[model samples]
Target chain A: MSAPLRVAVDRDACCGSGNCVRTAPEVFDQDDADGLVVLRQAEPPESEYDAVREAAYNCPAAAIEVTEP
Target chain B: MSDTLATNVPTYPFGNAGLEPLLPDLGADGVGRVQLPTGQQAWLFTRHEHLRELLRSADFSSDFTRPGFPLIRPIPEDMPRRPDGSLIRMDPPEHTKFRRMLTPEFMIKHIRTLEPLIRQTVVVALESMRAGGQPADLVEHFALPVPSMVICHLLGVPYADHDYFQERSRILLAWSSPPEQVRDAIEEMRDYLTRLIAARRDEPGEDLISRLAAERVATGEMTEEELVGLSVLLLIAGHETTSNMIGLSTLVLLKHPEQLRQLRERPELIDDTVEELLRYLTIVRTGLTRVAVTDTEVGGHRIAAGEGVIALLSAANRDADVFPDGEEFDLHRGSHQHMAFGFGIHQCIGQPLARAELRIALSEMITRLPGLALAVAPDDVRYRDAVVFGVQRLPVTW
Candidate 1:
């Protein structure tokens, strides 16, 4: 089995609409002015895997990633 | 037909087939005319120089107030997009006002702020593709989302609602889609935006939607209906056109390995490469249709008052005077004043943003994936049969 998953993001396309941070603030963050995403923790705990992937798939730009590394 | 191409005018879908390359030959005859399958007669003007002239011309009108003007559909009575008219679909006095306020936002300097954000989107989308580890529809996986996301943030619309709008946009824009269904989609979109406006009014924010609502634009300056129309225009114009460019540019570069090699070797050529791609693709298709406000002669052909001409931007970019051998995709060509974004006061306001998005996306692809080639044959990939120009599905694998 692989180790637990973590979140990575495509910062370019985030648009900073704040949906990801709204859904799972533990995994995502955004710049105050631009509202573009800034990863709070690049590799969150395994418990957060589902939330991270949901955010990735849900991203308007599809600019989110759930990484396992 | 305009009695000009009577002998050989291919109708509708077939008319589109031969249109991609006539950019140089804005016909000397009258603005070539065609009867769309819908029974709508729209004029086609092929050539870059004339497109520029008409865009800035006083005689050319953007007002659809007159009968038989070629707006895709009428604004529903319930949601009057413009009591008078929206800026984009209007002539000077109004068009100039909207651009004066909005142009600064899209100029190259201000738009550059979004680059870092764009690159982030690119990296994430690419990572997902790499992880999925399968041949994927690049259009859906990457091309479509980037601009929508970017525009959503720019407008302050909830990026969360991207899928909802994207689906509605697809329905509204699909070629074979029934006119009624497309109109229905527009209505649905208007309804959703109406609600968003209400919410923004209650809670003002920095997003584009909120700015309009908070500004109380309807209080003698501009109406809420016009604001909604502007939002829709920005969303559709900002995303769809840019998406097609991305897909088409990728397809062309993949087909011409030599050009790709040249770019990979000289990374600095990416900016010019992107401009060349825009000039080459001219993907927006027919220039925004304009009616003749007064009798005028364009390219020595008389356009009678009340008649609108579809200034064929694609054809204009190909004019031999404007561009030599315009058919050839020459990245090194120093052709700057290209009408890819349009001309005059009515020129495309979102060009700076569009250019930024494409330059980043294309250059990054070249620099990162040196061996990238299409997973499937170009012939198999589907180009949309849009009255508007676009690729339907571009499936690619590296």
Candidate 2:
């Protein structure tokens, strides 16, 4: 089986557009206080892989990072 | 690849006659030099990949005062240019400071909290239009008022004064408005916002302007002048862009009855429908303008430090490689990657709010007004000659 996906977010670089949260709510969320990305799951399940990738791809600020095994 | 020579460059802010503006041939690389109405020559990138690179690059500056900034219209010579806290026209770390201050206010979660307010506003607009009977101007009755009232409520601006601000905003946005008129409009908007800011400072309320006045301005985190500029930007941008999108999206949907039927059948598709409509109608027809602060190579073209570049978002949204059969409107086409709200740091900050408004407004329109149809012939419809693409009036009946 493939290794679990790795995800990271840079709050400083996050313009807080929240595309990540919308695209992959299971893996990501917006901080209620600041609206920056809050990494809910650093290693999400296989089912969330596609959505996680799309989130990284579509993020306007390029603040989301994903690593696949 | 052919290079568009300076002598033969096409004029931009292309005409709005067709569903999509006819873009001039920009050679194999999808990059060309075009002539602005100001008589300035700027590099135009039409391809999706090229726009992503150009917009995301930190070497480009959004400051209009910069030498070689691609100005779509000529500014009056005597008008003093001070774009203080106009976040769209600013570059980091200044842009960051202002954007961060307001990010929490517009995040999806915060916008979700405003859904009740948006729905109420939408319902009120629909009912009001219905009260006027059939064959009403949908634009004047529904499209303009919903966003105007919502934004005014959020900013503590009086909706009764919408005619005044809306008229000035029209002049500010119209390409045909003379440079002097544009200058006067800006002054008038600034003067009005200045008074509003002063009022908020003295008597704080539960609104954005009051909050900013009490917190940021009072704490010296931002200045009153900066607040005035920011308020002016939000006030104008809040209503105009979304208003145009609502009007145009309705027209597009009414024309595509099949898709409209699908949306009505599956209300769950409202989210995807909103995305597709935004992608298809990339309303900022003039495109986002920026000037290079450092030499950069984009799409194999060497752009010098002082050169201006225009990211044609409309062209990029319809790039064939990204969206197969991009020309056709498909409600099922997952279009999250489209640059309708633009890209990178300067991406539309009000997008989440815009999305909520569009989803509620369009869904309500289709559901409530079952027999909605254009009262005038399709050919008789008039388009606005403005920075934003929209119908001058949408005469409709249910």
Candidate 3:
């Protein structure tokens, strides 16, 4: 089996546009308080890797980071 | 220069005047005060770093009703404040709530699926332009209709209503429009959207309003009134800004034939070229407005609560610190860092759609009109005196 994807977010840089959550809700979410990203699964299952990568690349604020760890 | 910014907010199309020279007068610290058309003094942020930070700050709010929120022009005191859920003027969870519901529709991947529709729309628009004969106005023929038709289709509004909506959009966005005229245009827009939403609720389609009606509104997650407001926001913003960019960017490229020739020769440069044009033009000439909800420090300057702040996107987009040789437009520069879409949570939800439209439309313009040249003298071209900077009409001939 392939390695799962690891996701992280720099909340400070997050402008709260929520592109991450929309792209990969299983791995990322918006904080209820201020709409910043909330990491749900640091390492999501292999099936979600495509979406996680898309989220990282498409984050308008460049707040999300993804790696295969 | 400072006097002009402080007393009489300067006219639109700041053009190559590119906010760089005015930085010193804005302040050594990159933050200072300037006056708005509302005849109110507000803080203006000029540097890129400071603008990015301020846009993301929770201490600043986009709420229109907030004291010290900068108004581009005055609104009547009797008018009701903008609806709570309008995308442009919301904060945090509220903004996030609305944005999340709409994000799936505008995601780059999803918008790419609409490329065929966008391409078809452009082809039809160009054909219509040709039918109008030579020495035609690009604004009416191509710039305005393509976006208007695309937006109408996306929103499920009738494309036949373009003249009606376009006229209303122009009046609403005009900087010097009388308050009563602005109010009437807004009312007409809201009423039109309200009717459209009601119709969509009864018989749904594949468009955004239909989707919202079936998913959000029917679920009680969003109210009908809020949906109507959101629809108004989309219809107006979707067409007005992109249409303006299409017109003005064409004018900019036509004026600089060398740059135009370069883009035509290197088709791969279109992506970078579009970004460069967005950065260079930075057409939202009114700047992003916000108010300090709490005391905050920006660029070493402490702003009190309730103080208005205007982040000069046009200035920051051209900041030498971020974009070297920032004043000049170079298509191959390949840098996409631009405040053309504003920033933060409220940063244009429709940006992906806008970018796709711009790339396709501009590329098609060059390929289809190889001999495209200005029909009018550069000085004779009329520029719209509006919040969104654009040419009023660009007469072009092959």
> Which structure among the candidates has the greatest lDDT?
2
Which is the better candidate, 1 or 2, if ranked by lDDT?
Answer: 2
lDDT of 2 by residue, B1-398 (tens): 12234587788767677567669987767888888888788899999998988888898999999988889899999998887979999999999999989999999998999999999999999998999898999999999999999899889998999999999999999988999999999999999999988988888888999999998998999999899999999999999999999999999998899999999999999999999999999998889999999988898899988888999999999999998898889999999899999999888889999999999999999989999999998878889989889999999999
Query: What lDDT tens digits, residue by residue, belong to model 1 across residues B244-352?
Result: 8888888888877888899898988887888788888887664667777777878787777766567766767777777889888888885554667765445676776
DockQ measured for candidate 2: 0.79
Q: lDDT of each structure?
A: 0.69, 0.90, 0.80
The predicted structure with the larger TM-score, 1 or 3, is 3
- DockQ comparisons of all candidates to the true complex: 0.01, 0.79, 0.14
DockQ of 1: 0.01
If ranked by TM-score, best first, what sequence of candidates would result?
2, 3, 1
Q: What is the TM-score of chain A alone in each candidate?
A: 0.81, 0.94, 0.90
lDDT of 3 at B67: 70
Instruction: Provide the clashing-pair count of each candidate structure.
Output: 17, 0, 0
Instruction: Please tell me which model should have the higher TM-score, number 1 or number 2.
Output: 2
Better of 1 and 2 by DockQ: 2
Give stretches of model 1 more than 4 Å off: A1-69, B1-31, B36-43, B71-85, B216-220
RMSD of each: 15.7, 1.7, 5.6
Candidate 1 local lDDT, residue B307: 65
